[model samples]
Target: MNRLFPVWRRCAAVWVTGGLAAVLSVHAYAQAPTQRPAQSATQSPTAWTTSWSTALQEIPRIAEPPPLYQAPAVAGRTVRQIIVPTLSGTTTQLRISNRYGTRPLTIAGVTVARSAAGAAIEPGSASVVTFGGKREVVLGPGMEMDSDAIPFKVTRGAPLTVSVDAGSDAVMQAWHRIAGRVSYVSSEGRHAGDIPAAAFNVRFTQYAWITRLAVSGEHKGGLVAIGDSITDGLRSTFGADRSWPSELSRRLAAAGATPMAILNTGISGNRLLSGSVCYGDSLESRFEHDAAELPGVHTVVVMIGINDINFSSMPARRGLDCDTPHKVVSADDLIAGYRRVIATAHRHGLHIVGGTITPAALPPAREAIRLKVNEWIRDGRAFDGVVDFDKALRDPAHPDRLKTSFDSGDHVHPSDAGYAAMALAAEGVVPGAKR
Candidate 1:
C-alpha cells in the first residue's frame, strides 16, 4: 500500500470560523486525489452556497445495461427535473457538468421555475438560465460550467423545477444514478418552456446533466455527505428524503441550529480506494470535486470503506462484473486513505467528521476489519469530529449486525428508523447542530 501520509503530523494549532473549526495540515501527500489539489474557498454568506448537488457516475458501455442505468435520449427535446433545495435565497445559480462525457454537450435553452406539480412549473416563476448572458451553452467535455446568477426567490425544502433543451446532438454519458426523485423527459421536440405536463410524458429516477443548484444568502455553510449506498439513500422510500443526511437536514432546520445545506455525494457501490465501471470513480480520487472544493462547503461526513474491505472477497461473475478490479485492502490501507482525505479537507479549511462504519452482517474475518476501522474512527481523533453510526444502529445483543428495526431488509443498508437514528448521532458532531 502507498504511504499517502506515511506519518500523521497534524499540528495542534487550529482556527475557528462560522461555528466550524479546522486544523491546518502541514504534511506531505504521497498519494493525492486524481484531480488537482483542493483549493481553499472564500466561504461567506454572500458567496455561492451549493444548496443541492449530486455525485455523478459514468454510464456503462457494456453489451447491455439495466434500465435504470440507461440514460434517456435528450436530442431535440426538453427535459424537466424537480429538485428540492435545502437553503433559501433570493439569488441562485445552476451548474451543468460534462465531466464524463466523451464529447461536448450543447444546450439550446434552460428555464428555472418553482415546481407546481410533477413536471409542471408555477405559471409566472419561470426564469431564463443563461451563461455569460447567452441562453445557449456548449459545454466542453470534462468541464463544469455554472449559469449566471438568476434573481429568483427560493425557500428551503421547496421543490424547484429545471427544464433543459439540449441541442439535437445531446445524449447522457454521465449521470447521478439512483436519484430516488422522479425527473421528466420530453418525447420529441423542445418543451423546456412548457407549462403543461403533457409534453413531459416520460418519468425516470435519475439526475441528468445538471449538477448543482447554489444560492447566495445568510447561510452558515454547507455540509457534504460522501460515501456509498447507505449515504446514497438506497432502499429507502423513494422521494421521501429518508437518507441520514436528509433526516439530519430536517432535524437541524427544525432545531434552528447550524442551519446549512446538506449535499449528498454518495454513489451506490462506491469504494474508498477502488473504482467501478458503473459506480463512478473511487471516493478518495473524486473527493476533491465531490466534496473538498464544493462551494460554501464547511464540513464533510464520510461513511465509506466497507466496499474497499469487502469487494476483494467476492468471486468474479461470469457476466459483466462492475466490481472487477476487486482490489484487496486492509484496515491499514483504509486508515491511510482516511488520513489522506482528512488532510485534503484540512488544507481546504473544512471540518471533516469521521463516521464509524456500520454493520453489514459480514463473516467474522471481514467483521473484524470493520470493527478495527470503527475503533480508529472513535479513538484515533484524526478527524475534526466523529459520528459513531456503528454504535447508533448496531444490535445491542448481536453486536455485529443491524438492529432488526433498523434493517432495510437487506441487513446491509439502514431502514428509515435506522437512518433517523444515524441523524441523531450525527447531530452531536456537527458544530451547533443541536437536537
Candidate 2:
C-alpha cells in the first residue's frame, strides 16, 4: 500500500512537477489570499466575515417541460419574501448572479428584514439594500454583484427575508431549485419593502437570482460541502433545513464546536469530470467559483462521482450529452479526478476531505466499481481527511447497498435519518471542531 505524503511534502511535489506558473494558475483560479490594505491606526480593526452560500443551479435547456416544475422562470417581478436561515452575524450582504443570462439584468430595488411569519416581515426591521450606495444596479451577462453591507443583527437559525425587484430587463433568471423553503413573488412591481404576503400572490419553492448571503462576524473559517443531489438535499423535506450540512451546522453550534459557516454547493445530477446543461458545471470546472473563491472558506467536504458511475451505464437522454451511454469509467479515472481536486485545494491552503461513495442498488459490475473507488479513497492518502459515508449508510448484511431503514426508497439517496447519520460521521473532521 502506498502511504500518503504529508500535505507540505505533497505541495512541494506539486510545485516541482507543475512548476511555479502552474501553481500560480491553480492558486489564481482558486482565488487564494492576496495582500490587503493595512488598516489605519485610527480605523477600527476589520471584522471577520463568513459567506454562507445558497448553492446555485443551472437552468436546464430542455426542449419539453418535465412532469413537475422544480422552479419557475420569472421576469418583471418582485420576489418579496425569500426566507434564508442564517448562522451568525451582526451585518449582512447579498450576492446575486446573472451567470446564465443572455442580457443585462436590472435590479429596481432591494430590501432585507427579519421574518415575523410566513411571508411577513417584522415591523420596523425592514432595511433597504443598496449597491455601492446606489439604489439600483445593472449586472451584465455572466456577472455577479454583491450588495453593500446592511447593518442588521442576524441571530443564529433565524430566517431573514430578502426581497428583490428584478426589472423587465432581468430575463432568464438563474435560480437554486429545491430551496426546501417557500419564497413569495409579486406581479411586476417594486414591493421589496412590503411586510405582508398580501402583495406577493405567488409562492415558489426555490430561490431566485440570489446566490450567497455573507455576514460579518467572528469565525474560524467556512465549510463547503460539494457533491451531487444527495448533498443538495433533494429527497429531504421541503421548507425544512434538514440537509446533512445544515444538521452538521446545528450540531456544531450546539456543541460549541469550531465557529465555521457551512456552505452547501451541491447540485442535483452533478458529476466530477463532466458538465451538463441542467446539472451545472462539473466539480473541476466550478470548484474555484463555487467553493474556493467564497469568503473565508478553509475546508471542503466532497462527495461526488456517483453520478459519473451510474450515468455511465445508462442510456443517453436528450439534453444530457455529457453522460454518454455505455461509457463506463475505471476506478483510476475517478481517482485521477479526486487527485486533481485535492491538489488544487492543497495549493490554495484549503483542506480537502474525501467522502467514500455510498453503496447503491446497482448491478454487480457497477457495485464493484464503487467498492474500488471507496477503497482508493480510504487508502489513497490524496485527501486531508476521509468521511466514510459508505460505512455510515451501508447495510452490514448486504454490504453493497444502503441499509433498508436508511434508504430513501430510490435505493440511492438517503432518508432523513441517514442524512443525520452522515452528518454525525463527519462531526469532528472539521478543523478545531470539538468532539
lDDT of each: 0.81, 0.72
Q: Which residues of candidate 2, in runs, are more than 4 Å off? A: 1-48, 62-64, 67-73, 81-86, 318-326
Report the Cα lDDT for candidate 1: 0.81
Q: Cα-based RMSD of the predictions, in order?
A: 6.0, 7.7
lDDT score for residue 99 of model 2: 72
lDDT of 2 by residue, 254-294 (tens): 88875678878888778898876667778887887777666
| Among all candidates shown, the one with the greatest TM-score | 1
User: Which 10-residue span in candidate 1 carries the lowest summed lDDT?
Assistant: 1-10
Candidate 1 TM-score, C-alpha based: 0.90
Candidate with top lDDT is 1
